[model samples]
Target: MTPRISALLAGLLVLTACSAGSTPAPSPTSSPAASPTAVQPASGPAITISGMTFTSPSAVAPGATITVTNSDSVEHSVTADTGNAFDVEVDGKGTATFTAPTQPGTYPYHCTYHPSMHGQLIVG
Candidate 1:
């Protein structure tokens, strides 16, 4: 065969071989990153730990139970920043509660494990 005709035949063979294969796979779709759940409003006296932050209602009644939940992957605890007012520990994906102080004032608190994690409890 002529050099030109041979090249044309080789190109046709390559095209035929490629088309003989199975159907192509579908492209994968990207998924959204997981997000932490919203902090549930404190029904009465409760403190929640989500996204590595402590959250509480504006004010809680004295002598009431204060619930704390740690939703992060690491352990965290609630410790009174002053006077040793209250100390509670909640493991990773765990829940715990402590009784509110009797005095009516703002009680500052923090995570003993994480100094940057802090919050305040208003007793009134």
Candidate 2:
């Protein structure tokens, strides 16, 4: 065989071998299944912090995801008043998230940056 033809055949074989051994890309309509673990973040409602105040959302489910949106010009945080329930810091005009406690209750949280700024999270 000609030198050029031999080179072309070898390149085609390499490509075929690579594609045959590799896994196909996932389809856009399909999603990877996740194994359940002890800790998994579940998305829920959202909390908006504007005008140096915390606007708590409606009642949330226990062990749900709590997202914080800080629209102020300064950074803020959502910190539990008592035990370490959940703490998430968000920058000015930024957002952050935290996992809610498994036990349902009224959780009072405050901004670690601004002590006067406080909010309550109602979980059912």
How high is the CA lDDT of each candidate model?
A: 0.86, 0.88
Instruction: Kindly report which residue stretches of model 2 are placed more than 4 angstroms away from their true locations once superposed.
Output: 1-43
Q: What total of clashing residue pairs does each candidate reach?
A: 0, 0
Across residues 45-67, which tens digit of lDDT does each residue of candidate 2 receive?
99999999999987899998878
The alpha-carbon RMSD values of the candidates against the true structure, listed in the order shown, are 9.3, 8.2
Clashing pairs in 2: none
**Clashing pairs for predicted structure model 1, backbone only:** none
Best by lDDT: 2
Q: Which ten residues in a row have the lowest lDDT in candidate 2?
A: 30-39
User: What does the lDDT come to for candidate 1?
Assistant: 0.86
